[model samples]
Target: MRRMLKQSALVRDNNFKGGLKEYAKEMGKIGKFATQLKIAGYVSIATDIVGSSIKVYEAAPEDKARTTVVETAKVGAGIGFGIYASYLIVGLATGGTGLIVIGIVAAGAAIAAKGTSEIAGYGAGYIYDKVESINE
Candidate 1:
């Protein structure tokens, strides 16, 4: 009985070590991919900014176009900041995990951040519109 217990303990230790080694190797791969993912994210943001600017220019009248452009820029900045802040917070919260795990958590955080920001912006805009109408 004693010999059997010793052998089982040894097996469990070996399995744990093997699993940890595999997890480390996967994390290394995720690290390499993270660089590429970051580059893609930057490109995506630039594309969104340019596209939004073009739409604002085309849609707004001549007198309002500049103001629309500025407002669009503000919105973009807010979204960018929100995403970065959320990412930082989530990264800190998941400090002990691999990049893949961090990415997953950060993505969820970013999505939630974006959604909440949009809702807040819409609510503020609605309130401002109502107040302006009441003043008029």
Candidate 2:
């Protein structure tokens, strides 16, 4: 029984050392790939924003163009804040350095921010319309 225990211990030590080295190498590769993914994510966001801006410009009437611009600005600000805040919170919670993980969190936060921005914009527009009508 004592000899069996010693053999098992040696086996465990050998396997653990080899496993840790391989795991470290794989983690380094994942980190590099995640960084590339993060860059692609940001590029995609920029293109989406630009494409949406162009569509808004084409669809909005000459008079309401300014309103559209303002609403777009508000949405942009909301998304920016949402992403930043989410990154901070998630980073603190998980202590993660993986770009892909943070990117996923940011994406979800951005979607939530979009819904919030739309609601706020609608309310602001309604209030503006009511005030203008009252003034006239």
Candidate 3:
């Protein structure tokens, strides 16, 4: 057991709780709403590709401090999407046409949102990584 452990260079405690805890903080004052997530390699790549155009609006000094805009936007979107999905369900009563249209729109919106959000999220992560690297 000791030989195997030594050969593998295994540490007793393998708690990879992330090294850069406050990556978002490194890019401070980025706007009214700011947030970050501990994403994986694939996400970072995706973010890099799509975040090329999306500009991150930073907060001005004169503006009063408030809750993070990123978090607020995500939460609001989540809630909004939920409601929107529910609309499709309720609209089923209107008629087959209404249901069909709503269904099609909802499906398209969901797919687009999924891709857009991923790219946006990756953009945020990419920014954080770059900021942190520069700071270091």
Best by TM-score: 1
Residue pairs of candidate 2 with colliding backbone atoms: none
Reference-based TM-score of each model: 0.53, 0.50, 0.32
Would you list the C-alpha lDDT of every candidate in the order shown?
Answer: 0.56, 0.58, 0.40
Point out the higher-scoring one by lDDT: 1 or 3: 1
User: Candidate 1 on 44-104: residue-level lDDT in tens?
Assistant: 5676567656767666474354445344644665566656765674464334354556667
Q: For residues 31-114, what per-residue lDDT tens digits would candidate 2 score against the true structure?
A: 675576567557756765776577666774853654765466556666676667655645533442444665566667666766
Kindly report which residue stretches of model 1 are placed more than 4 angstroms away from their true locations once superposed: 1-27, 62-74, 82-94, 98-100, 120-124, 127-136
Per-model C-alpha RMSD: 7.9, 8.7, 23.3
- Which regions of candidate 2 deviate over 4 angstroms? 1-30, 60-63, 89-107
The clash tally of candidate 3 reads 7
| lDDT of model number 3 | 0.40
Q: What lDDT score goes with residue 55 in model 1?
A: 60
User: Cα miss at 61, model 3 (Å)?
Assistant: 33
